[model samples]
Target: MTEFDEILKLEIEARKKIEQAEKKAERIKQEGIKQAEEVLSQVQKEVEDYRKEKQIELEENIANLKQELETNFKLRVEKIRGVFEHNKERLKSIIYSVLGFN
Candidate 1:
């Protein structure tokens, strides 16, 4: 072949190699995007799960605090009631003496 023909053949082969490299780069870019999307989706799901778990724990803590407060309140009320009961006779006598019925 002539030198011109050889040069033309080399140019054509270079272009084909460049086209193949570009196609490979595009595929690699697409695969990277897909992997990034998958990782983002997984992270979002994990965050949602963690939030739900924390919410449940918070609700349980609130319930326990409410129960503790209610128990403390009931105990205080019972003590007041007992004191009132023990003083019932003294209160009645004082009221009667003030009304001149003692």
Candidate 2:
């Protein structure tokens, strides 16, 4: 064959290789995009699950704190009642002495 024909054949083969490379590159790019989307979807689902778990935890904590506060308030009220009961007799005796009723 002539050198020109050989060069032309090489050019054709090079172009086919380039086209194959381009197709392979495009396939790789599409696979990468698919994998990225899958990862993003998984991350989003995990984030939603985490958010729900945290919300439930926060609600439980709030409920526990409310119960603790209510218990503390009831205990304080009971103590106050006890103190009032203990002072009642002395207060009456003092009032009678002040008014000269004893």
lDDT of each: 0.98, 0.98
Summarize candidate 2's per-residue lDDT along 1-102 as a digit string, tens digits. Answer: 999999999999999999999999999999999999999999999999999999999999999999999999999999999999889988999999999999
What TM-score goes with each of the models?
A: 0.81, 0.85
Worst 10 residues of 2 by lDDT: 81-90
Instruction: State which candidate has the highest TM-score.
Output: 2
lDDT of 1 by residue, 4-56 (tens): 99999999999999999999999999999999999999999999999999999
Clashing pairs in 1: none
